[model samples]
Target: MPVEARYALLYSDYEVTPCLRIPFEKFAFLILTLPLCAFIFCIIYSVLFHFESATSTHCHVYNVLPSISAAIGNFSPQREVWQTAIMLQSVPRFYIAVIYLQFHHAMAYPRDAWMGNFAFLLNVTENISLIILSFWTSSRHYTVHEKAFITFILMSEFHMLLTCIMQSRFKRHNRRSLKWKRRLFLTNVSCIILGAYCYMRHNSLCEPYMYSLFAFAEYVVVLTNMAFHTTAYFDFENKDFVLYKYGAAITER
Candidate 1:
């Protein structure tokens, strides 16, 4: 799609998906307001601890920590990282919604050509879980109880990046079938084991060791996932360009 044409979604006459053609008037309002909504979600999420600080006198076992523990829940530098992560997280969800609207259009018009709605759904679910994990790990006690979650996040990161690489490299092939999904599940479980190792050797009692390790592991995970997915996207768009150019609409697995 042309750059102008892609942005023309707010005013264009193209079909929302392969199916139903949508008027810009119908979705323009929602689409126009999404950035605002994402901003709000980030603001609220960033200050969740600050929001709770007024009520946290108990200092439960989960709140042991040295000094930063008292500040983890606030909008400090530590909190800012999650603010960014959670906000970026919304991009995938927004894309998911765009695909969903197209799905609705396709059902209405009966001409949609996008493949693997299930795969798209899986993609959305993974991103949602990822964002949640990011926020949860920001908690002061998250390391104590759920360090394993980071391992799972790393596992998914590698899995999705590899999946994207595979898809991009072999666009004409059917690669992610039953065996692939099983392999993914097994690999993800192993990630949890890596987390266990990290925890057993943990130095969480220190000033910033806890957050440093947590952030380090998560930074690598997010960067790898995002970069691979972004590259795969261009590959996908290019493939779609070719398919559209050649009038090749039907694909079967």
Candidate 2:
């Protein structure tokens, strides 16, 4: 959200960065959104894992449906475990959206540190998702696949929040040097750590195919965000970071 707000300010002809003509804009953005749409679909799929639960999850989902569809696509969560499993992604993602918005607009004003604070609570939001899902699933034993999927997403969100904070701190360093090797190393390291954690947490569980796809999407997005940061001059070294990064920042604008 902050990124969108910033893009509005920065790219608007009336604003800071002014405008630059981008080529193949439509195709490029569609490609970028495809991964995000997949990630979102994975979340909706998780919600489907839990069809019977204490809370309907359906009500909230129904109410939020149009908005979600507008943001991503038509994917919806139908089952209780799916509803429960999905919260692992949906809840923390809300924070990510808000923080991204807050950060984007924050450039126009420094007081938007609220984004940072919101980011710190990522673990809490994720845990809350876990608690709700666990309680719901415990009512009826969840599949090992569901359990592992939940574990992977929860861990990814926790780690993504860490990456957000770390990246923000790098920006604070003034230069925010663009070193693909450095960035890729850190991101891959994050992936390895998250994979290892998931392995440790659910060694007995059967890994879901959906979760593998989700992990792949998340890995790609980490690289995408780096590309985004490079374009925003949120990083120092000017490289030809893929234009797809700007697509994300531009969406909510």
TM values, all candidates:
0.40, 0.26
lDDT at 227, model 1: 38
Worst 10 residues of 2 by lDDT: 62-71
Query: Model 1, range 1-253, lDDT digits (tens) per residue?
Result: 3432332223223333433223323233343244334434434453464534512333222322222223333346544554464565476345533443342333322332233343454466566665554465445446632554545465455545444333433325334332343444444445445534443445444332443343334333333344333332322232221122212121111
Where does model 2 exceed 4 Å of error? 1-28, 49-181, 204-253
The runs of at least 3 residues in candidate 1 whose Cα sits more than 4 Å from the true structure, single-residue gaps closed, are 1-81, 96-115, 134-196, 203-215, 236-253
- lDDT agreement with native, every candidate: 0.39, 0.39
Model 1 RMSD, rounded to 1 decimal: 11.6
lDDT of 2 by residue, 108-221 (tens): 235545544554465445445444443344324546435743664555455455444555544343334334434644665566566555434433443433234334434454
User: Candidate 1, TM-score vs. the true structure?
Assistant: 0.40
Angstrom error at residue 59, model 1: 18
Lowest lDDT 10-mer window, candidate 1? 244-253
